[model samples]
Target: MIKVLLNGCSGKMGEVVVNASKNFPNIEIVAGIDKFPTEKYNFKVFKNTSDVDIYYDVLIDFSRPEALVDLLNFSVKNNKPIILCSTGYSDEDLKLIKEKSNIIPIFKSANMSLGINLINSLLKKIVPNLYENYDIEIIEKHHNQKVDSPSGTAILLADTIKNSLPIESKYVFGRDGFSKREKNEIGIHAVRGGSIVGEHDIIFAGSGEIIELSHTALSREVFAVGALKAAEYMADMFYPRIYNMEDLLGI
Candidate 1:
């Protein structure tokens, strides 16, 4: 069995993961870490990773970016692999994660949905062919409670396209009173309302045709399932490195 230490145990995604992991009998959530501890959970939940005393084979994080430092330190000290599902990490945080990956295996992804990662792989193949004539724009929607604008998945898609393009491309997030859309720019727009699970649309406009690649997450379970899969993948990994969806999916 793969024993998992779940972070953000009281959050929405954490709840979803808790519910979903029941189907995988081989995986067990031994303990959790959350700022707001509750008595309802079957497993013990602590306020922080430092307080955790349970034995876990891997760590799964779906919390905020602020938890990165402590998470990395604990994982490194314990020599345990971690699957980070949190978004909105700053460049410095990413650098720290990457540096620490030299000591312990770290799996990170902006979007944990397998469909989103597959869409990313599809974007890489098609963006290069259409980059010259197509004008690309990305639209993303999430729950109103989401703190970050232009969801990390949106940025991931934009980066996928940007990296595949022949020339340099700049990102313009939600333009207001813009003179005109630049030729070498990728426009990203965000919508937040109600309880949207998640939605991402990549629009490619050309003179005669428009091609759109879209993915709608009906529920958070998809991410929970993917994160568990990542947790399983990380459990057996002894190598110290930063891994992503590409590594998980073997893309």
Candidate 2:
């Protein structure tokens, strides 16, 4: 069995992952790391990642950004593969993750659903060719408690689309007073309400035609399942490399 350590086990997504692990017979979660130790689940919870003693084959993190450095440090020190499912990492934090990949196998994704990663790859191919004629916009929605605005996934989509263009593209998060959409701008909008799991839509508007691509996540288990698959894949792989859902899915 692939021993697993779950970070942020008390959080919403973490709880989902905990339950989802039961479906994978080859994966077992031996321990969990969380700031709050409320007795909602059956797993032994550690207040910090350093307190865990059992040999974990891989560490899956769905925690907050504030706790990422400590988690990354612990994973690197123990030489365990890490799958970072957490969102809202700053550019510097990403740089740190990239640097640490040299020492351990690191898998990071803003969104873990295989479909989303496929969409990202598709956008990379379609965006550049349609740049001159198409106007692009991205809108995403998540649970009300999500801390990040526009979301890391939205930025990932935007960045992928931007990379396809020869000229630099601008990101417009919101419109305030007197501001109009620029010709080279990629509009990104975020919606937070209710108990929605997640939703992302990309709109390509042109002369008389409109193309819309969307993905809706009904449950968090999709992400959990993907993360578990990533953990199993990384267990036997060599370290010092960064991977995403696409790499895990082999697409």
Candidate 3:
């Protein structure tokens, strides 16, 4: 079995992973690191990653942005590969992760769902052909308790579409004042409501016609399963580099 250390052990996603991982025959969660450590699972939980004394082949994180620095430090010092699934990282945090990749392999994604990653790949192909003639806009909705605005996944989708353009395209988060939509601006909007798992919609509006690409995440298991797959893939990666769901999916 591929022994794994799950971070954010007490969080909602962590609980989901704990329950979902049982079906995977080759993976076992040996320990967990959480700010609020509890005897909540069969394995031990530590408030700090450094305090963990058990053995684990890989690390999987679905925690907050605040835990990132310590996690990176511990992982690199111990030479453990990690799949980072947390969102809401600042620019400097991302820079630090990229730099650390030279010493320890890291698999990171804003969203872990395979459907979203597949949509990311499709946007690369879809953006180039229609961006010039179409005005792009994205609408994303999530549970009310989610901390970040215009979620990391929304940014990922927007960036994927923006990067596909030959020229620099501006990202407009939301519209308040009545202003004409610029040709080069891509609008991103976020909605927070009750009990919604995840929803993303991208519209390409032209003079006469409109096209929309959308995806809805109905359950948390999809992400848990994908993260487990990523964990297995990253378990044996000795090379120091960053990997993503696209790499695992070969898209």
Candidate 4:
């Protein structure tokens, strides 16, 4: 059995992962770290990672950005592989994750859905060719409780497209008044309401036609399942590197 350390085990995604892991016979969550610890679903929870005594083969974190830095540090100190499913990390935090991957395997992704990764790969291949003719726009929606705007997944999509372009593309988060899109600008719009799980749509518009790619997540369990698969995959690999769900899916 693969022993797992679950970080942010009290949050929404954390709870989903905890419940899902219980049904899998090959994996076990040995310990959990969460800020708000209340007995839920008969799982033992601690307020910090230091309280856990068992050696974990992999650490899965679904916490906030504030909690992620300490979690990454602890994972590095313990020399344990980490599957970071959390979103809202700043550029500096992302740089740190890349730096830490030299010593320990770090699998990170903004969107854990396999389909979204596939979409990202497709975008990378298509964006360069369509750069001149197509005007790009990304619109994302999440639950009202999400603190960050535009969502990390949206940023990832925009960045991938931007990297593919010959010239650097400017990102316009929102527009007001009589503002018109620049030729080299990628527009990103964010919407928050209700309990929506997640949604992302990318549009490429031209003179007479429009091409669109979209992904809608009906449940958060898809992310949980993907993260578990990543943990299992990481346990079997020896190389230390940063990876995304696309690498896991071999797209």
Candidate 5:
């Protein structure tokens, strides 16, 4: 079994990952690092990565941005692969992550759901066909407890669609005041509600017709399963590099 050090193993998504691990027999969470460690996991928990000395094949970080620095340090010191599944990072944070990728193999993706990534690739082809004739807007809904608005996945989707367009496009977040929709803009709107696992809708409005491409996640298992797959993939890799869902999917 590939031993994994699970970071942020006490939070909601962390709990989901723990529960979903049973389905992946090849991966085993040997340890966890969380601020609030609990006995719920069969493996031992550490308050910080620095304190742990276990032999883990990979480190799967679903923790907050604050924990990133320590996790990278731990990864570098141990020469281990890391699967980053966290969202909400600043430009500086991303730069730091990129720098750290030179030291260890890092797999990072805004959305770990394979369906979302497949849609991302599909949109690369789909956007070019429709961007000129239609106005596009994305609506993403998640649970209220989730931080970060206009989710990382929303940005990822928006960027994916923009890169595919022939002409330059601008991104517009939730608009409240009446402003005319511009032709060169893609609007992304986020909604927070009760216990919504995840939902994304890409709507294209044309002269007299409409088309919508959507994905709804009923459970967090999608992300958990994807992350586990990534960890196993990374553990087998020996080189220092950055990876994503596209790499994992060979797309």
Candidate 6:
């Protein structure tokens, strides 16, 4: 079995992961780390990485970006692989992740759902064929309690589309005071409402026709399942490098 040390154990996603782990008998969450650390779990919970004394094959984080440093430190110190599922990481934090990846295996993904990752792969293939004539826009919605705006998954999709475009395109978050939509602009909009698991829509508009691709996450279990799969994959990754869904799915 792959023993996992789950980060952000008290959070919503963490709870989802705990419940999802039951479906994967080979993956076991032996311990957890949470700032609050008040919730009762079947496994041991620690307030910080320093307080952890349990044995785990890998660390799976669904925590906040603020916990990145401590988590990375703990992973490196213990020579354990880590899977980072947190979003909204700053550029500096990304750099740090990449830096630490040179010493220990680090798996990171803004969104872990298989459908979302498949959409990312699809955009790479589909965007290049239509970007020249199609004006693109991305709409993403999440729960009100979500901390970040224009979620990491939204950015990931936008970045994928941008890379596939031949012409230089810039991102426009929202069109509040904008007079007109520029030809080389990719619009991104964020919507927050009540208890939305997640929703993403990618729109491509042309002279007379429009095309849309979308993915709706019915529940958080999709992500939890993917993260657990990542944990199982990372369990034996002794090499030092950064991995992602592409690596996990072999796409």
- Candidate 6 lDDT for residue 21: 97
In terms of TM-score, how similar is model 6 to the real structure? Answer: 0.98
TM-score of each: 0.98, 0.96, 0.98, 0.95, 0.97, 0.98
Number of clashing pairs per prediction, in order = 0, 0, 0, 0, 0, 0
Each model's lDDT comes to 0.94, 0.89, 0.93, 0.88, 0.91, 0.94
lDDT of 4 by residue, 125-159 (tens): 99988888999999999999999998999999999
Judge candidate 6 against the unseen true structure and give its global Cα lDDT, from 0 to 1.
0.94
Q: Counting only residues 3 or more apart in sequence or on different chains, how many pairs clash (N, Cα, C under 3 Å) in candidate 6?
A: 0
Q: Please identify model 4 stretches exceeding 4 Å from their true place.
A: none
Give stretches of model 2 more than 4 Å off. Answer: none
The true-versus-predicted C-alpha distance at residue 99 of model 1, in Å, is: 0.6
The all-Cα superposition gives candidate 5 an RMSD in Å to the true structure of 1.0
Clashing pairs in 4: none
What C-alpha lDDT, on a 0 to 100 scale, does residue 86 get in candidate 4? 81
Residues 95-199, model 6: lDDT tens digits = 999999999999999999999999999999999899878899999999999999999999999999999988898999988984899999999999999999999
Cα lDDT tens digits for candidate 2, 97-182: 98998998899999999889999999988887888998999999988998999899999999999989999889998666897778
Residue-wise lDDT of candidate 5 within 139-229, one digit each (tens)?
A: 9999999889889999999999988988988999988788888999999999999999999999999999999989999899999999999
Candidate with the larger TM-score of 2 and 4 = 2
Model 5 TM-score, all chains together: 0.97
